[model samples]
Target chain A: MTYIIKTNNLTKIYQGKEVVSNVTMNIKKGEIYGFLGPNGAGKTTFMRMLMSLVKPSNGEIIICGEQVTPTSFELLKRIGCIIEYPVFYDKLTAKENLDLHCEYTGYYNKKEIDFVLDLVKLKDTEGKAVKDFSLGMKQRLGVARAIITKPEILILDEPINGLDPIGIKEFRNLFQKLSKDYGMTLLISSHILGEIEQIADTIGVIKDGKLIKEVLMEDIREENTAFIELKTNDVKKVAFEISHTLGISNFKILDEATIRIYDMKASEGEILKTLVVKDILVEAITRKNHSLEDYFLRIINGGGMNA
Target chain B: MLKLIKLEIKKFKLFNYYKGVLIANLGFIAFLSMIYFLERNDGNIPFENFEMAMNISSAAIRTTFIIFAAVLIVKLIIDEYKSKSIEIMFTYPIGRKKILTAKLMIVVAFTFIMVMSSTSLMAGLLYFAEAQFDIFPVELSFQDIVRNVYVNFFYALATAGLSLIPLLFGMRRKSAVATIVSAIFLATVTSTTSDNINLFSIIAIPVSLGVFGILIGYLAISKIEQVDVI
Candidate 1:
């Protein structure tokens, strides 16, 4: 796959502390690359480096095949970004802010301004100054501004921080449409996995200022093998019933109240029938995939030890 | 460069400051009138000599516009850093130094224009008052008027440079209050020299201060590319 953005040993140091250390990452063209990390995990710093807002102290970033020196800002013309949070001339209207953004990026098609506002549901905010805008409205407008130029790559850091549930869903659709319809490359950072899990083609989990894991969503999907989950108050009774009644050996007792049978040799119905025959209370049982959620938790909670 | 300057003005809505300028002019005129009435002691008027009158007026004008320029610097540059909006500007497809230069240029142009207009206003008003009231025994000749303009031009240029010094203080801490306070301090110390001291009375001091102020601006942004934006 041809990469549209690449970084080699990309790092940023603040006061002798490496906030981002040697993050050599690749992003393919027209793909949604989700940057997943908790708060203070150097996600914002990494995005800032990619956006050329912060000069990397000991590394290099190549975007569109151009090395971004302090003098070279031409590559920025092809990028749209909103770092940390959306900030605008507080006195100016949302429309005015978007227009200025377009002018700075040298994208002069004024008509697209209205189109992006409409897409982000900020079209009704005509004369209201941005200072009066609610945080959610500012977020919507931030997205509007980022996509207004139809930039080849969009670097949005924690773009969904203050959105309502409906707004998050709408943004998910919008991000998908931008990738599929306009062929835009997106690098979105979020601490919440649910925000990125739905639409991201690739997810990069970061921890303690380092990228712990990077994997394709397809590979994650393929690795989600089926497993049986059984919940009961009497874990000892269930463990005895599970092995004795079903002769199942590949199973794990998670806690006093839960067990996971990884082997699929026994069907759900047979296991439920055997539990009922043994006069044991099977409170709940269901077949669930070892989800990407588990993988995200393992990497995050383990602090890269598992990775 | 001009477009970048214009963009800065539009972004900050700086054109709305005309009202403040008008108010300053009205207050300046009132202040000069106060000096005219207050300094007349038993037929010994300060305006009897043209040089004393011009010296007092220029000092006041220099202080007002220098402080005004510092306020503009606070708005145009310091506040941007404080609010972190400068991150947005840096991400744009423009050189960082170029953006900073445009902001400082606006401050300089504003200091120059406001100083020139207000100085002329003060000069014209002084001439009109003398012509109408015949208060000064000294002649308000065309030569004096021409010289006033000439002297005020250099003062405006000098004040423009002097205005930039506060940028050094303001940027060091990225504080708005610090910027304005330094402006006041600089204006007072530089313009309040007694006549016998003969230090601030000459053009050389303000000119040197102006040049030093310009250097301060250069020093602030010299490492623009290498330094962390924060």
Candidate 2:
């Protein structure tokens, strides 16, 4: 697997405190690498360092096999990003802002502006100044600006922060299209697990300035163990039955009314039949799958994802 | 580098600034005419010599245009840092020093050109007015007015560099108020006159201040690469 972006021992310190510490990560080519973290988790600082807007306190970043130095600004031509909220020459209209961006990014294709605007559904901005845009519109414009250059790598920090539900879905689809069709490697940062889980091929969870976990979305889904949950008054008897007669040792007693059986040979029908034969009052029984949010919290909490 | 400067101008819509410059010129000419009329009529032997009139006008020009340059610095430089937009610019494919140099070039060029043109315009108009209306008993040779223009050119160049001094104060805290206020303070200090001998007349004072201002500009861009935008 070719890595499009790689960092070794990356760190940033401010006022004698480490904001991001010793993070070594690799983002594969043409993949959506989700950077997951809560607020103040140093995600913005990390992205800024990647852009060389902030110098790393220690370590280095290599992009497309070239080391990133203070003067290696030409390397930035290959990347497009929105480190925080999108900012622009708000006094100018949207087209003018995009024009300026293209000029600075050295992208001479003026037609690409309309193409990106259409991609983000901002075609009829009505010649309005960017200052007049709502948060959602600004977010869309931000995406448009990031993709206008057709960069090799896209680093977006909370790119969908202010979008509505439908807009979020649209961005999700857009990100996928950009990664799939345009072959752009994307590193998108966000705190929402469900939103990222839907789009990110690989997930990296950052908490307290350290990356606690980095794994493929499929691996996390595979860890989403399915279990049988039985809700009844005699939880102890069911637990005993689950261990002896059912011959399943992988089980947990959550409370007096809940017994979760992780491994069961008998089907739900057979299990209910056995309970009924044994004169057990089974109020309700159902199969449950762990959500990715729970799995994310487990990784953040440092283990016990299966339990 | 020139392309970057043009892009900066286009980005900030700086072409619109011409309206303000025109207004300043008109206001300044009116003020000079008022002073000429009042000093002559108020029993003070107004402009006893050609040098006195030039000195007074140069002082006013330095004060207004230097502060005007500072206002531009606030708009084009300090405000971007304050709003964190410079971070975005730094991420571009251009070198940080080149981008900053382009911006300072705009400010310095604007200040120098305006000061020289305004001073020359005033001197020319003053000479014609003397020939036309005999505003005062004082006389000026053609050579004297021509020499004054050359002198004002140097002063204008010095003022261009001196105008950068405000960036020192403004960048320290990224405060627009601090930038404008410090500019006003510098202009007042340089423009204060007594007997046609202000600090600028000393020649050494303005020159050194100009050097110091250029030094500040140098210091700002020297380490901009390593310094975090935050």
Candidate 3:
């Protein structure tokens, strides 16, 4: 498989401190790569390097088979981005800002601009000045501007930071649809783990300016490490049934009315039906798993301990 | 480069709030002409008064145009730097030096148009005042008028070039007030003190402009190309 983004021993130092230590990472074409790290973890720095907005102190960055450099204008034409905050002239309307971006990219497509507006659900705000826009609106306009040119690679840094839950759901759906249907390779950085876990094909975790791990989501899922939770008044009965019927006993009682079936595939409806037939009233049944959040905290805490 | 110029023009067309600068230029011209018209009607001041007023007004117009051009362009550039919008331009599929050159070209072109219009407007108002109030016995020759106008335009361009020095030095400082003060101080000292030096005044304007333009252009190209935009 051809890699869209490849970094070899990429490192950056500032004022005698290594802000981004020696690191290597690969992102395949047409893959949704989730970059997860805490604040000040050099994710933005690395992204800037990839876009040729910043020079790497050491090592190499190859994007789309071409070496990244300050003069890599041809390579930049293939990418779109929102680094740090999405800024625009306050007096300009949404359409005007997008039009300006189009001018810079030398792509003239009013239809594409309108399509991206509709995609980001900003169609109603065509004429409204950016100064009147809320933070969420500004962020949506940023995404619309970034994608208006139909770039093959989209790099968004905390794209959904100020969005509401509805906006986030819309963004998540849009991201996945764009990647799958439009064949766009994405490098999205976020501190929100649950969201990344849902859509990312691969995850790159960074801690203290250094990449700690890069893992495939398929491998994580195939590990069979997920747990299921059952809520009921008869916790003991459900635990017994889970152990007896499923033949698995590596479980824990979470509370007075809840139990966790560890690392097992317990069907939600069937398990509830079996418990109902056993005269055990189940309130709710949900899959419990070690979320990306849990894993991120674990790795960060581990790094702290090692330090 | 053309695309980058288009982007800069779009920015100007969309978000220009300093309409005051434009009005200030016209208003000063109108005020000076009105003063000349009133003086001519009353016949209170001598012919030397008309000459002096004409000289002062011409100098004021040139100075105002140069100041307006400098502040407006430098402010726009500095604000982009402060808000970090220059990063967007730098990462766009265009060379950094080309982007700077495009912006500089836009500003220079815009300045030329504004200066030309303002100079003509001042001349028109003065001509009308002269015709109405019967100010001086002798009319300025057409050739003399055109020559002076061109000279004023060159003065504006040279002063605009000089202003870029403080702008480049003070961009990272982020204080427009300080930049303007330093620029004024530098301009006053440089223009008035050519007496102590043996340098010829006729050769000084182009040489100074060339040196300053080259220096600022170099700083901008190097900085924009190497700035870490994160």
Better of 1 and 3 by lDDT: 1
- The best-first sequence of candidates by lDDT reads 2, 1, 3
lDDT of 2 by residue, A93-206 (tens): 889989999999899999999989999999999579999999999889888988999999999999999999999999999999999999999999999888899999999888
Give the clashing pairs for model 1: none
Write out the backbone clash pairs for model 2: none
Against the unseen true structure, what C-alpha lDDT does each candidate score? 0.86, 0.89, 0.75
lDDT, candidate 3, residue A273? 76
lDDT of 1 at B172: 81
All candidates: DockQ: 0.71, 0.87, 0.60
Question: Relative to the unseen true structure, what is the C-alpha lDDT of residue B121 in candidate 3, on a scale of 0 to 100?
Answer: 67
lDDT of 1 by residue, B111-226 (tens): 98898888888887788888888768877788888887888898888889879999988988898898999999988887784652334577679789989989998988888877
Output the number of the TM-score-best candidate.
2
RMSD of 1: 3.0
Full candidate order by DockQ, most accurate first: 2, 1, 3
What tens-digit string does per-residue lDDT give for candidate 2 at B38-125? Answer: 8768877777767777788888888999899998998899888877778789889999999999999999999999999988888877
Number of backbone clashes in candidate 2: 0
**Number of clashing residue pairs, candidate 1:** 0
- Candidate 1's TM-score: 0.92
